[model samples]
Target chain A: MRDVAIVSTAQMTNVRREQRRNEVEMLMPVVQEAVKRSGIPKGDIGFTCSGSCDYLAGQPFAFVSALDAIGAWPPISESHVEMDGAWALYEAWVKIQTGQADSALVYSFGKSSMGDVPDVLNLQLDPYYLSPLGIDSISLAALQARAFLEKTQYTERDLAKVAVRSRKSAKDNPNAQLAGDFDLEKLLAEPYLVSPLRVHDCAPISDGAVAVVLAADDTARNACERPAWITGIDHRIEPHQPGVRDLSESPSTALAGAKAGVASGGIEVAELYAPFTHQELILRDALGLDASTSINPSGGALAANAIMVAGLTRIAEVANRIQWGSIGRGLAHATSGPCLQQNLVCVLEAK
Target chain B: MASGDGGLLSASHIVEYPYRRSTGPVMGRFFAALRDRRFEGVKTARGRVLVPPTEYDPQTGEAADEMVPVGPGGVVTTWAWVSHPRAKHPLNHPFAWALIQLDGADTAMLHAVDTGVESAMQTGMRVTPRWRAQTVGSINDVACFEPEGTS
Candidate 1:
């Protein structure tokens, strides 16, 4: 496989809402900044790919309009996915591996504030059974959290600690939507949003976008001082129906982690895309991450979940830290679907 | 901090797909049985019965054509108490969204349990389907599940 490295990354400061600017307008600056930092001209970008959900936009083919942000004046070769931007990055990586492109641009955008976000996600469920029942997203996660709690020794307090630590970590992240030195006692005292899960346990519905540039071999060496080289990347999926699989454990994540060579070396940091507090614990165990590994130093999805973009942000977060020469190697994870149904694991190392 | 000179304009935009979709063969069998106040499942090659059955085996792509009767009563494999129901929820008052493993079925089905009190819900609680008076050949034909001993 060709050596692909993430040369640059940029993202908008996550907020509760971005009502004035449309999706395209919100993504334009981020995409420009990422390319600028890479020192790769727009014309030189071999391919462009994005991840976004039209359901969030409340329109059909909404992603088509987002292409305007990348400047289609010359009609560049680009593709889009109905998933998180991490999957888009995967597609661009494949394009480069096949000798189709030497460099690629990857971006994702989402505005959960556009409508009732949880309810909007309900539309993605199986129409025959789950969807007709009007099962919103949080309640589904609550079910998973309850199952995880009953099967393990983890309690509500343990879940609260995860929340407190994440928010504290977010304090250093300027782009995070929720960040502060939260009191653990005060947090545990909060009421449940949906039984097992408190509001703090859930990722805040956020609006934002993220963009990252990828260059292969010589292109990567010339673009940045230190490129976070992609040593291994793989994604796996489980049965779509939640009942068929074990909710307490994430076999798919573990399988992907193994394929991505997560445990082959000592990982200094890990950016996990767990939207709920208990899910972080689940992914951590699945990926075999020890207590010594720093998890979600950028606050993770729990601080600012920009729907289609948060997964990609996780990858960018770890890459940014690696690019700065702070860490030698790290793992980044992205999850899609309810109860960790689909997962992608990517391992990055400093060059 | 200062307020912006111009405030943003907004309007309500309803997002919906207004279309009639067929439930298809496998799902149609399950829903049609619901209309008759009965539960049906499909038998897989592994001899496992799947409730709210799919046309093909989940693990393999093999077609599953045998329809078998499942249950009007089942044990809750897992549950989450919906302390406050949303406007779009099946029930107005508090309920638990549970995955009920019906008798003779290998997989559980997702539905609402109208247990009123959150304390009344538990993982292994026995529940029965409460069907709507007017059945529409849809999953909602069974309004919600209720505690087995309850009226």
Candidate 2:
């Protein structure tokens, strides 16, 4: 595989809603910022890809409308996925590896505030069996949390601690929606929003966008002085039906981590896209992350999850840290589907 | 869609697939059984039965053959309490969404248990289907689950 590094990354998040801007308007500035930071001309970008959910937009081919932000007047090579931006980054990485594109642009956006967030997620369930049941995202995740608690040693308090730490970490992140020191006892005293899961355990429904620029080999060296080289990246999926798979253990995450070589080196920072507090523990165990690793230093998904963009934000977080001269090596994880059903892991190193 | 500032067009639209689709072989039998107030599962090559039967085995991807009667009664494998019911929820009262492992079935099926209170629900609780008086060969044919001994 060619040495591909994320040359530049930019994002805007942690806001409850972006009422004024459409997806294109929200993404345009981030795109311009990322491309400018890379010092790469917009036209020099060999490929462009975006990730967003049409369900959230409530329109067919909704992503096509987002193309206006990138200015496709000259007709640039582009593709899209009905998934998170991390998956879009994966596609761009594969394109570069295939020698089809040397440098690429990836961006994703989500506006969960437009509609009933939990109810909207029900549309992604199994139409025949699950959807008819009207099992929304929070309820399904609550079920997972309950099952996780029953099987593991963790408790609601442990989950609360994860929430507390996440928000505390977000205090410095101006882009974080939920931040500041939370009282543990007060948090525990809060009533459950859905049985085992309290409001704090769940991610804030957020609206935002993220853009990343990737350059391979010499293009990478020229674009940034300290590049966060992509050492390993892989994603894996499990059976789609939640009942058929074990919800407590993320075998898919473990598989993706193994393929991404997460355990091969010492990780200085880790950004995990765990929307729920309990899920962070599951992903941590799956990826073999220990206490030594700085987990979710940017507050993670729990602090400012923006649906489709949160996963890509995980990658951008680690890459940004590497570029800032704080982290030598890192691992980033992104998950999709219910109960950590599909997972992607990427390992980054400073060079 | 709300009207936006300037000339940019905005309109509210409800995106939905207002259409009917065939359930196909295995699921056809499963729903047909539901119409008769019965429960059935597809027996896979491994002899394990999967409720909400798929035409192909989930584990093997081989064609599923035997349609075996599984359960009108099952035990909750795991559950989460729904304190405030949504309009779309099966029951208006508080209930538990459970993964039920019916007798003779290897895999679990998701459904709502109308427990009325959170304390009434628990893992391994016995529950049975409460069928709709008028069945239409749909998942809602079983209105929801209720405590096994309750009327």
Candidate 3:
């Protein structure tokens, strides 16, 4: 595959609710920033791809308005994914690999706070079986958390620890909506919002936008001093039915990680987009990351869980670390559907 | 074009769905606050406050527990004139949608503006919320933003 690296990443401050602005208003700045930072004019971007959910905005063709954010009067070649922006980036990377485009831009946005986020997420479940049950996102996650606790040695306290650590790490992130030091014991003391999962164990309803710019080797070298080279990128999907798959193990993520060559040189940092705490642990085991590697230095989805944009933010966070020369090798993972039914893994490096 | 059996079976399916959402406790509180003619934001662990409060903080990824009153007025950070409005937009007439940073809040809130004069709506224009007479538990509770000096 041809060498492609993320040259610029920009995102709106993740918030609980973006009431004053629509998705287009929220995305314009991030898109402008990404292109401006890359030193590439908007017209120069050979391809554009975006990730978003029609359900979140309560409208079909939600992505069409977002095009206004890009000022597509001239009509640039563009496509969109019903998945996360990481998958969009992967598609852009493929476009570069095929020698179709030397540079590409990927973006994602969501207003999860527009309605009941958990209830809205329930729409992602199987329409025939699970949707009829009306099992919302948090309730389903609680089921997974309970199963993980029953199957593994991890405890509720362990889950709280993840919340505490993630919140503390979020202190440095200006765009993070949640962060701070919290007593794990105190968090545990709070009544359970969903039995096995406390309120802290669940991600908050959030609204935000993000954009990333990708360039082939020649463009990458000219744009940034230390481009985060995307060495391998791959994604996989599992059967949508939750009953058929092993919820405890994300076989799809593991498979994608292997396809992306995540274990090739040992990942120094990993950005796993697990909105729930237990999902983080499941992803950790699936990606084969140990305590030695730094996880979620940007506080992760638990910090700023903006649905469609959260997974894309993971790729940007890991790439930022490489761009800043903080890590040598990193793995960025993004997921969609219920119970991690779909996953994308991207291996980034600095050379 | 002809089919093997000398007959063509051509069909097209057009599906339209309207979603009904139940505003849960947090969002319910937010809309309730709006109905009361007050702007509220959820306070995050980092101490930065966001308007139309997020149920969770974007930084810590934790649920926002504290509700803080933000603003009825603030400065317009950035705006774009909506010369052509979409079907579902709050306003059917031509207007400018702006990102207004409400007073006492760290971030901006998006809403439509009724300044009438598109040329006057700049990044730093001061504006105030124009609330709807009939308040529903939705973002449309605030009809739009109007230039502070106009009314």
Candidate 4:
């Protein structure tokens, strides 16, 4: 594989409801900022890829509308995925590897505040069975949480601890929408929004966008003094229905992690796109991450989850840290579908 | 739509699939069975039966058409209690969403259990489906599930 590195990243997050600007307007500055920071002229970028959910935008081909933000005047080569931006980055990486493009732009956006976020997610299910039955995202996650707890030795108190640490850590993240210290006892005393999960255990429903730029080999060296090299990246998926697969474990994540060579080197920071507290534990175990890794130094999805954007944000977080000269290597994970049905793992390094 | 300069200008937007599709061979048979208040699963190469049967086996990716009787009754493998009902939920009262394993099937199905209270639900609990008064060729024909001994 060719040496591809993420040269720059930018984001707009922790917004509870972005009522003024539409997706295109929201993404314009974020994308522009990323392109500018990468030291590559916008016109010189070879390819572009975007990830966003049409259901969240409440329109067909919303991604095309979002292209207005990128100024496709010259009719640039572009592609899209109905998934998280992390997948978009994966596509851009593929484009670079295929020799079709050396430098590429990747972006993802989500505005869950525009609709009934949980119910909107139900539409992604198998229409004949799951969707018609009206199983919203939260209920599905709660069921998975129950199964995870039953199959493992963890309990609600452990989930409460994860929540407390996440929010308290978010206090340092200026872009985090939900951040603060909370007594673990008080959090445990909170009523269940749905049994097996309290409000704290769930991520805040957020509206946000993220953009990142990728350059391969010489282009990467020229674009930035220090690039977060994409040493390994892979994604895996399981059956569509939640019933057939074991919700207690994320086989997809483990498979992806192995393919991505996560265990090849030491990881200083990790960004796991776990929308729920129990899911963090499951992904941690699935990837075989130990105590040395600083998980989610930027507060993770539990602090500000913006659906399609959250996964890509995980990649951007690791890239930012590596570029900032703080961390030598890191692991980032992104997941989609109910009960972690699909997973993508990427390993970034300073070398 | 609400109008305000404080970013409150809002309009309701709804999304729907623009096309209607056939449920295919296996699910068509499953829905037909659902109309008569019968439960069935598709037998796969792995010797497992998947409820809400599909035309293709999840494990082997082979074509699946063998339908077998699975359940009107099943055991709750795992459950999440919902203290308050949502507008779109199958039940209006408190309930639990569970993955239930029918007696003869290897896999489970997602459904709601009208347990009436959180404390009434638990793993390994026996439950049975509650059919709708009006039988339609739809998955909704069986409204939800209830405890085995409940009326």
Candidate 5:
């Protein structure tokens, strides 16, 4: 694959609600910041890819409105994913790998606070069987948590510990919505919102946007002092049925991790988009992370779960770490569907 | 819904979408079962029988065939108390959404549990389906699962 690196990353603060501005308004600043930070003119971006869901906006073709934020006057090459912006970055990286584009601009945005997020996610299910039953996202996740508890030794407290650590980590993240240290024991004591899962186990609803700029070798060198190069990128999807698959583990995630070479070349830090606390535990085991790896240094989804944007934020956090010379090797993960049915993994390295 | 800001004028507007789907035998059967006011579960390749059955075995990716009745009653695997329901939800009033694993089925089905008393609902609670007065070829046919003892 041709060398491509993330030269710059920027995001709007994750908030429970952004009633003042729509998605286009929320995305404009983020796109400008990414281009400005990359030190590249808007014209230099050879391609653009974005991640977003029409369901989140409660309207179809939501990404079409986002084109205004990019100022596609000349009509730049572009594509979009119903997944997350990180997946868009993966597409951009693939375009660069094909030797088609020297640089690419990727972004994602969502206003999940506009409606019931869990209910909207039900649309992602198998329409005939799952949708007819009206099973929303949170309930599906709770079923997974229950299955995990029954099969594994992990407890509700373990899930609470993940939340506590994630929120504490978010304390340093300006874009994070939910942060600050909390007593894990107290969190466990809270009544179950869904048995085996407390309120803290779930990510707070957030509305936000994020953007990242990718450039080839020379372009990257000119754009930033230290660029986070895309070493490996891969994604996979599993069956959609909740009952058919094992909820205790994320096979798709493990498959993506293996294909992305996460285990081959040790990673210094990892950012995983686990919207549910129990999912973080499932992902950690799937990704093969041990104590040495710093997971979610940027607070992760638990700190700022912006639906479509959270996964891209994980990529941005890892890229920023490399841009600042904080870490040499990093792994970033994004998930979609109920109970981690689909996963994307990207490995980054500073060059 | 808001009007698009037409910053750039174009002579023509084009729209495209794809809705091609293969509702395999199982989901086809489930939809057919719904039309008949009956639910079916096919024993998967993995030995777990699922209701509103899946078309393909999740493990082996093979076509699932054995059809069995998932009786009305089941144990709630997990549930969320929905204080504010959405537009497409089965009921407008507050309801407990649950993953209920019916007897004879290894996998669970999601539905609204109608315990008029919200406090009465809990995870692992026993509930039975309250079929709609009129059956439709959709999940809404089962209006909601009511607490076993409640009318």
Candidate 6:
């Protein structure tokens, strides 16, 4: 496989709602900033791939309009995923592996505030059984949380602790939308939005965009001072129905982590995309992260989750830390579908 | 801080995909049984009975062709209370969404157990289906599950 490294990454400050710019307008600066930071001529980048959901935009082919943010007068090899931007990065990396492009651009954006996110996500379920019941995303996560809590030694207090730590971590992240210190008892006293999941335990509805540049070997080395080399990356999926498997465990995350060789080397920092607090626990166990690992310094999805954008942001977060000389090696995780039915793990290292 | 609904120029944009498709044989059998106030599960080659059956086994990818009777009552394997129901939720009042492992079936099915209050819900509670007066061959044919012995 060709050696691909993240050369540059940029993202917008996440907010509860964006009253100013449309999707393209919001993405332009982030994409331009990433392109500029990479020091690569716009025309020279071989391919462009994006991650986003048209459902959020309330229109089909919304990504096509987002393409205007990238300069394509001569046209370029481009593709799109209706998933998180991390998947788009995966596609671009595969293009590099195929020897089709020396460098590729990846981006993802989502304005979750555009619609009622929970109801919108319901459409992703099996139409026959789940969707007809109008099972919202939070309700589904809560169901998993209940199961996880029952089958394990963990309690509701542990879930709250994850919330407290994530929010406190977000204080250092300027791009984070929600960040602050809170009394643990007070947080626990908060009303449950759905049983087993308090409002704080769930990710906030956020609007944001993220962009990253990837280049092979020499191009990667020349374009950036320190390229966060993608040593291993893999994704796995399980049956979508939450009942089919043990909700307390994430087999897909474990499989993806194993396939990506996450345990192959020492990891200093890890950015995980778990929208619900209980899920972070499940993922940490699946990936075998330990006390030495600093998790979610950017507050993770719990801090500023923007649907399609959050997963790719996890990749950029680890890459950004590696590029900044703060961490030597790290792992980034992304999850999609209900209760983490699908998962991807990317391991980055400094060379 | 300021807030106003009419401050920005906007129009209601309703996005919808109003299309209907056939349920195919596997799901069709499940719904057909549901209409008659009965639960039918598909039998996988491994002998595991899957309610709301998938045409194929999730683990082995083998075709599931056999059908078997499941239950009108079940045990709530797991549950999450909905304190304040959303506009699109299955029940308007406070209820619990549960994974019910019906009698005679190996796999659980997701549905609402109308307990009426948060305190009324329990993980291991027994529940029976509340079939609609006039049933259709659809998932909603069962109005919602109710705590066993509820009036």
Q: What is the TM-score of chain A alone in each candidate?
A: 0.99, 0.99, 0.98, 0.99, 0.98, 0.99
Q: State the lDDT of candidate 4 residue by residue for B68-144, as single tens digits.
A: 99888999999888887889998888889999998888888888998787888889999998999998878789788
lDDT of 3 at A144: 64
lDDT (Cα, tens digit) per residue for candidate 3, span B29-148: 777888887888778888887765656765467877688888888887555454445444457676765557788877665567787756676667789988889886566777788999
Which stretches in model 2 have alpha-carbon errors above 4 Å?
B1-12
DockQ of candidate model 1: 0.75
lDDT of every predicted structure (CA atoms): 0.92, 0.91, 0.81, 0.91, 0.84, 0.93
lDDT of 1 by residue, A44-95 (tens): 9999999999998789999999988888877899999999999999999999
Q: Which stretches of candidate 4 lie over 4 Å from their true place?
A: B1-12
Best by DockQ: 4
Give per-candidate clash totals.
0, 2, 19, 0, 0, 0
Kindly report which residue pairs in candidate 1 clash with one another: none
TM-score of chain A of 2: 0.99
Ten consecutive residues with minimal summed lDDT in candidate 5 chain A?
A: A126-135
Q: At residue A178, what lDDT does model 2 achieve?
A: 85
For candidate 2, the per-residue lDDT at A87 reads 99
Task: For all candidates, state DockQ relative to the true structure.
Answer: 0.75, 0.77, 0.01, 0.82, 0.29, 0.81
Residues B38-86, candidate 1, lDDT per residue (tens digit)? Answer: 9999999999898879989888878998999999899998899888899
Give the range of the ten consecutive residues with the poorest summed lDDT in model 3 chain A.
A126-135
- The 10-residue segment of model 3 chain B with minimum total lDDT is B9-18
Stronger candidate by TM-score (4 vs 5):
4
Per-residue CA lDDT of candidate 3, range A1-351, in tens? Answer: 788999999989988888689988999999999999999888999999999988876777878889999988688889999878888898898888899999999999988886667767767774432554344666556556765776789998889999999999999999899999999889999976655567899887789999999999889999999999998888888765443345667888988999889888878889999988999999999989998888998999889989789998999998888988889899888988876778989899998
Off by over 4 Å in 5: B1-25, B42-50, B60-107, B112-130, B144-151
lDDT of 6 by residue, A1-351 (tens): 889999999999999999889999999999999999999998999999999999998898988999889877787999999999999999999999999999999999998999899999998898889999999999999999999999999999999999999999999999999999978999999988898899999999999999999999899999999999999999999997777889999989999999999988888998999999999999999999999899999999999999899999999999999999999899999999999999999999999
| Model 1 chain B poorest 10 in a row by lDDT | B1-10
DockQ of 3: 0.01
Which of the predicted structures, 1 or 5, would earn the higher lDDT when compared with the native?
A: 1
